[model samples]
Target: MERWKINLIVLWLGQFMVMSGMTMIIPFLPLYIQEMGIHDPHEVAVWAGLIFAANFVSSFIFQPIWGGLADRFGRKVMLLRSGFGMAFVMMFMGMAATPLHLLLLRLANGVISGFMPAAVALVSANTPRERMGFAMGTLQSGSVAGTILGPLFGGVLAEWVGFRPIFYITGGLLFAASVLAAFLVKEKFDIEQAKTRPKMSVFSGFRELIRIRQLPALYSVTFLIQFSILSSMPLIPLFVQELHGSGQLLAFYAGLVGSVTGFSNMIASPLLGRLGDRLGSQRILAIALIGTGLAFIPQAFVTNIWQLLASRFLLGVFMGGLLPSVQTLIRQYTPSGMESRAYSFNTSALALGNMLGPVIGGAVSGLIGIRGIFMTAAVLLLLNALWVRLSLFPRNQVQKTGS
Candidate 1:
């Protein structure tokens, strides 16, 4: 492999490991709350929802701050801070004796969680423009794969070594990633460009981020993409329960489904990104939204756990392309010096979706059932597809860089 390919692989691996570890906390949180003596479903649900949303709430608030800092200071610095910070928080979470403690730790972790965004900034800055889409896609696959595998392993580890051990394992993995990143990752800002880069105030930069004309559509699309994806997540465990799977087997099934989806995402993301580079991010985004909508629509009727898992895997195949394409589009829309704020805005939108998705999922699931949740997500996605088609597709407006 070439030198750049080698760097890409290492970077991608580090990101994957980091994401996998972070996500491990997701699948087992409620169970841990139960073990700590909270038995009321409503209480467990509330605490769990708070803990889950806490990270996003913090991250959403801090994402742009971190992004601008990365631009001014360095991407690697932010990546190291995020990786190490998350590791410490995860370890602290494992040691928590109360829901409140866990919630606090999660909130702090979210405030500092900028590793993936930093990595994207690094890739955007380092990779050639022509290959940037592919690089971003590869990086995104790591995140998707992490989400898939983290839950899978989290469920199994929680069952075997118990929830506390899973936390230790996740924290250890993140720390290890930090160590790797510390040694291997290098920043390469253009010194000449750096010197000439205008010093935009934080408020002005944020104003610019929000005021960018095409960005709202991009941000809206990101929110809907994440919303549609997560709308199905919190209920997957419940769906497994309806399949007559025991709790022990349910954990394994969760991992199995996660692994399958991760595999599909891993396989498809880079190819799709490469395609986006050739065809246009708008084209890829439109196709992905439509495919995801169709895939999600059938999941509501899944007859068994296997069928449900299969639908998830199929959905992953389409959804895997969406993030990188969005990243590429954001880069295309913003000027070179403004990349950090643009990415920060994108990250914030996704974090907002993360924070909102589960609360809505829980409420809607309570009112209409899990099946209805899937249908609701499908309708939302379909609406997004139409909106993109009617509005965003017209200009063929995959803007070129610095436009």
Candidate 2:
């Protein structure tokens, strides 16, 4: 097997473990706060929100710094740094005696979190350009699959072994992933070339990359893709309640509604990526954006949980095309020696989207209600599609077909 293929397989598993470990706390975060002697429901809610947001906030700020280092040092080293750093932090989180300690630990975890972006950089740098779409799509599938199953596994383990022990288990998973990467993942990095590369500060590197044609637009698309999809997530349970009524099965139905989209997304990501490789990633991105926008409309008006689930599933299928295409575009446009920095900037956009999505969603729901949030997201995505068409597709440039 080729070296790139080996890195892809190992990094795919590493990405899965990293994402899974990070999300495993989602199901019991609030419960953990409550256990920390927080009796008031409102206090628990506030602490949970703060603790959750802490990671994204730190990650958004530090991603570029790490990206610069990855460009100078090596992507595999950065990956190991994040994987092991997160492992130790997660284990210590199990030992946290107070909410403050947990909050600080989450912040530290965010600072050390670069495993996914580093994995993408390594794979992108090593893979054949013609197969970039397939590799990216395959890599994305692993991350999405982990995200879809993490909460489920976490919830079950939390019930069986309690909250703190779940943290220890998550830590163990991360450590094992790091060990695999250490032994198995290979990167053909030119150390002398990397050393001789011109040095630039983080912000300057970001500015230099942003000057590349089509990159800023691609970054915006990345942000909008995440913002549009995640903006409605927090309100799903409320929307489900409105459709199904508050019943004993509400939690089960809510989980189903949430997981169904990811299930379809996991299936569609690689298939659509392969299609993009043939049909042109720009074309697939345009169609997926339109499809996703239209899919949100049905969710806004769904009269029952089943209708909502179907709509979300359809949305997921289209969504599978968005990020991989964007990443491929980024790789195509970025100059040699700055791929990691470019990907890191993209990661920053993603972190911003993750951080702001729920806050804005909650605020929007308060103003226009949950249905209005859906409509707003649909409009934003549709407008994003127009932006892509105008900025990315030149009138004279013909779309590239198969490799």
All candidates: TM-score: 0.86, 0.97
Q: CA lDDT of 358 in candidate 1?
A: 71
Residues 201-298, candidate 2, lDDT per residue (tens digit)? 99899889878768888888878877877888888888888899987899889989989999999899989989988998999999999999999998
On the 0 to 100 scale, the lDDT of residue 154 in model 2 is 91
The clash count for each model shown is 1, 0
**Sliding window of 10 residues with minimal summed lDDT for model 2:** 394-403
Winning candidate number (TM-score): 2
Residue 376, model 2, lDDT: 91
